[model samples]
Target: MQKISQKSIHKYLRHDKKFPHVWCPGCSNGIVLGAVIRAIAELDLKKDNIAMVSGIGCSSRMPVYADFNTLHSLHGRAIAYATGVKMYKPEMDVVVITGDGDATAIGGNHFIHAARRNIDLTVILINNYIYGMTGGQYSPTTPHGDKATTTPYGNIDPTFDICKLAIGAGATFVARTSAYHAVETQSFIKQAFKHKGFSLVEIISACPVIYGRLNKKGDAPTMMKQMKDDVIPIKQYEKLSPEQRVNKQTRGIFINDTEKMEYTLAYQELIDSLKVPKGDSNE
Candidate 1:
């Protein structure tokens, strides 16, 4: 593999210094973004060959900040757009970045179908629990009994376990990591990128300004500290009792497996089997 430097990766950054970031200070989205950039740099993937697609929401803003060929698409349609991109230009490294609501709620259908088809795409779901960009509305990943602007009486719905959902949807690779664990998050992103078929990385991020304040999770620092303190390493988790594991454990790498015959590959095989000579007209 070709080696690339951080300086080279920095060149691909799209956000300007003068404008500053739109995200609130201490938000974990910045950390997730940094990890993603590091992963891409480590992989040595060419900037021009990579295409990043995003749906509407705070997380959707990520592609705008990334230096790759970016598309700020409609809400819950990022994966749909990315699927089209990959189907057309199979060589392109297509990535879909979306939020919990964008991926699991309004875009729920697209999410499952993409995984079911095993499209060659990497999906990074940045979940902050609430609709950060549109105030503190409850999202699909919002925990039960959590308070949000729209759920003033506490959220009654059960939250979606994104990793499990991805696995159930037939994703070749599925992993969950919190934003506080930058190293693990980057490593997981690298693994996801390397996985041949559909891959999904559900990153739990801190939204201090919106979700944090609304849910009384304290400031960004406190929320991140909670994550760091609560998240048990996968190795350490193996040693823990079942009850202990239930009490305080944020597991890692929940699922990782390869799938045979990804959608594009299967399509190509079908075409090859047709065996019609090029430029020949069949009667």
Candidate 2:
């Protein structure tokens, strides 16, 4: 029963005073960070036994700020690196943090395969629809026909629903939420950590500096307000008509199926079935 704060996490981290964080103002990355930290604190996970890995992006910088064993890895390979770490050290609570571009653009292959494997890991994907750190390029999550520096005329490219992708790729737990809903976002993250199989929480955050300026989504406050107006709670959504729900928002635990076997356990089962002789130390 520890509170998540600078003092509480200081003992577990390498550097404390050096962090108000380097992320831009009005960024949802901070909220996401707070949610994850809160979740870890709530779970009472040992900092020594937790590993956070990240790829290159604004969101990828998360591991650097977290008070845990961490790896700041190459672009688009956070999940792959995390999977390897978990496979070797199955006791670690491995969390992978990456942006939309880092996760789905260059990292698309790795992302899908990780989901397919159903590895015991929690993936926190912060999807803000543009490359925030690298001058606002259009990303895989960019809405169709939205403007970005790379898509000045209009995007015309389809945006990927990350939660749906994770679910379809075979992740055992999949959920989605916006940075606007801090409480719900934290709740989903906590649940994802508790789930034994591959779990994914696709956080739809607002990037006012990049996405808003380009897509005319307005300022940070405006973008947040849009989320508040658009995201329909699960309870209220259930009461809505089919017509009313069309093209409308719905946010909740979209999928939760724990029956799926995790990769580590499954691989162990395969080895057991093979009956490989235990006598080989180096033979």
- The superposed Cα distance between candidate 1 and the true structure at residue 11, in angstroms, equals 1.2
lDDT of 2: 0.87
Best by lDDT: 2
Once fitted onto the true fold, the runs of candidate 1 whose alpha carbons sit more than 4 angstroms away are 1-8, 15-18, 234-249, 277-283
Number of the predicted model whose TM-score against the real structure is largest: 1
**Residue 267, model 1, lDDT:** 81
**Ten contiguous residues minimizing lDDT sum, candidate 1:** 1-10
Number of backbone clashes in candidate 1: 0
TM-score of structure candidate 1: 0.90
Instruction: Kindly list the per-residue Cα lDDT of model 2 for residues 1-283, writing each as its tens digit.
Output: 3456756655554575657777888899988988888888889888889999999999999888777899999999999999899998988999999999999999998998999999999999998889999989999878778888889898888878887888889888988888999888888999999998889998888898878887788889999998887777778888988888753466889889989889998988887899967879688
TM-score of each: 0.90, 0.89
What digit string (tens of lDDT, one per residue) describes model 1 on residues 103-128?
Answer: 99999999999999998899989888
Q: Rate the local accuracy (lDDT) of all candidates.
A: 0.85, 0.87
